[model samples]
Target: MLVQMFDLLATRRDFFVGLLLEHVQISLVSIAIAIVVGGIAGILISEFQRAAKPTLAVVNFLYTIPSISMLGFLIPFSGVGDATAVIALTIYALLPMVRATHTGITNVDPSILEAARGMGGTRMQTLLRVRLPLALPVIMSGIRNMVVMTIALAGIASFIGAGGLGVAIYRGITTNNAAMTMAGSLLIAVLALVVDFVLGFVEKRMGMRSKAAKRTNRRLAVGALVACGVAAACAVVPGMVAGAPATINVATKPMTEQYIMGNMLKDLIEQDTNLKVKVTQGVGSGTSNIEPAMESGDFDLYPEYTGTGWAMVLKKGGTYSEDEFGQLKAGYRKKGLGWVGMYGFGNTYGIAVRSDVAKRYGIKTYSDLAKVTDRLKLGAEADFFERADGYDALCKAYGMRFGSTMQLDIGLKYDALEQGSVDALIIFTTDGKLSHANATVLKDDKGFFPSYECGNVVRTKVLEQHPELRAVLKKLDGTITESDMARMNYQVEEKGEDPEDVAREYLRAKGLLK
Candidate 1:
């Protein structure tokens, strides 16, 4: 397993290295901020004995919040990526740093302090020359613990579109790639261990008694700050190019289909025009994340599902309507977002089951599945369970109460069905795995789902600036059939082809690109 993990990771060495750099970037920023802020808070509280317990209680409360939940809470305000990741990591690292600083200082021998004061030491002098030196070991121990925790929690940052080693892990989980998942997990563990060992060694070597030791400590502190500054710069510099002329930013949701679409757009634009393109794919929350970024002009365009725009973005309710496309266009236009014509596929949501199970249950529609709810175990993705238009709403509409429902990663849903762990799985109509998994998709006899026609959702401002972009995008209209999408996805998911290569090949085969 270990050898296989390394072999899998070696296939994408550059990507894994970038993940490592990003993981270090956020971890360093969080730890640096924690040490300064937590150190100050610790010093302040130590002098005021009455406030120590209450302050520590507050810091501990932050420690109790789950890492992913904390990242989610900051998404709306920070809008994902490094800002949210760094802030959450900093808060998580605080409890240990603060407690350690306070414990180290307060534990100093009273007799030693009295002797220092009697020897003409002032309050500040006693703290700097005597107390801090004695407390260095304890304080460094807390810092070491915080660094390790931050490194581990940084993996969760990828859930919020923050790039890190965690993104690789989540992608592996979603794609049902055990070797990839193991590789990511092993890298994170290795990173944590390396950080712990280095910090531990430094802690042992530090002794403020000697002038040379004090100079070495100062040099180390300066080096750490420089590294933190470099990380911060690397994170912020990308946002600077958001509105650069003749450059476009494309984004995609976290799914196989979306990834293909994003890559397709990137390839088409770069080849057809003089404009440079950058793609940010596998973003969390689908439209929720992409739409906001588009509105803020952070991203120029992305492939979006019409039904998602109608229901989630437009906030309209009730049954699907004939005028839904018109309504969707108008709704997005109001928000300064333009919707291009559909890209020749309508990938709606449906309940799927293994072919043998479907035959045994006689389930051809959602209503038919409801009849066997008491015997069926349902499986769905994490977002499907949480979204308003997801599992709960689907159940209410179909009157379904399954024997059990397992929350799963989208990538693992097919595997779960093949293994018979789930009787039915929620799936997209165009998923390539449908054929591979030998799953039969049930029809929505009651018209519970709206049309999910895929299209390019772009910022009006971008279209206005590069008017030819609209025409370039329109060239993609009705180009890819449902089968084409499914086959393309299969190539990437099952055959291990890079999404960009799959998309590029599709364009070249269609004579759509040079």
Candidate 2:
């Protein structure tokens, strides 16, 4: 697994390098911002004893909000990118820094403070020279805690389309590529360790009272500041490396199949044109998030489902005509978006059961499973429980209720089923694990599912800005069949191939690329 992970890293060196720098950039910026805000807040609260409790309470409350939820709340104002990521991480880094600053300052000995004052020191001098230096160790400890936490939480930033190492981790999970996941995780762990060790060493050295030690600490602080400046430059430089090239940003929902499609489109566009294609994969909140970003011009294109665009985006329910494509295009036109073309796959949601359970219950269709639902336990992703076309509506459509339901991570659903923790699951039509787990997909016999034909959807303004984009994207129209998509997903999830590699091979095999 380690060898495979290294091999994967070597093959995608440029991409991984960008992600690494991005991760560092997000962490550093967030920590710097937190230090400024948290450090000041800590000082004020420490000095004003009456205000300490309530102020600390507010900071604590902010920290207690779930990471993803906090990020979601920030997206409306910040959109999807490094700014949003930095803001969210900065908030998360605050509590530790604030607490540490307050603790360190308050713990200073009273006699030492009085001595500084008696020596003609003003209140400010007493704080800067006496209390602050004495409190240096504790304050440094808080900064250390904030730095480590920020690095780890920066991974979650990728979910909101802020480029970072988390992109690799989430992609690995969606595709069931253990090597990819491991590679990302290991790198993040190493980064956190390095940051902690370096800061910790500095903190210890600063705690020494010797005059020579103070000189050494000042030199180290200068060196650290320089290092931070360089890191900030590295984080922002890569985004501009291509030098004003006509760029198209692609967005993708958080799933294996979406990864394959998004990368495929990115590869095709980059291979054929001078235009730079920046793909932001595994965007959370699905279409709800992606659509708004498009409207705000944050993304140029993404693979969107017809059913999602129709029912969810257009708010037109109970659909279908053979002419659905025309209707979808017309609807999106009003929103400054265009349906580029279909990729020739219909990836609707499905109810699936373990083969043994399928056989025992004679469950071959959704309705058949409904009869035995009271005896079955369902496991699905958290998103499935909340989607408009998700669990609640599905149950209503089939008139079925499971004995119990478990909301498992998308990557773990198959494991849950195989382990008999869940008798059935919500599954994507193209998930590779369906075969690995020996599961049988139940037919949606009553057509409870709307048509979910996959296609490229781009912002119309982006197409107008770069006329060749429409031509570049034409290469993918009707290229991948339904089975082809499933096989591509299988190769990633079950065979542990990278999605980019899988997409490249499929395009070559189809003679779309040499």
Residues 1-514, candidate 1: write the lDDT tens digits: 6777787778789888988988988888889999999999998888788999999999999899988788778877877667889999999999999999999999999999999999999988998888888888999999988999899989888776777888788776655557777888889999999999988768765754588887888898899889878867877787686674477988878788787888889888887777888776677766777788788777789898877787778878775554677877888999999987469987888888888988998889999998888798999877678666778788899898889999877788888888989989989887878887778888889888877788999999889989889888999999988889989888877876767688888989999988
**Candidate 2 regions with alpha-carbon error over 4 angstroms:** 6-13, 208-219, 234-243, 319-322
Top candidate, metric lDDT:
2
Query: Who wins the TM-score comparison?
Result: 2
Clashes of each: 1, 0
Cα lDDT for residue 123, model 2? 83
TM-score of 2: 0.94
Reference-based lDDT, residue 220, model 2: 80
In order, what lDDT does every prediction score?
Answer: 0.84, 0.85
In angstroms, how far off is 300's CA in candidate 2?
1.3
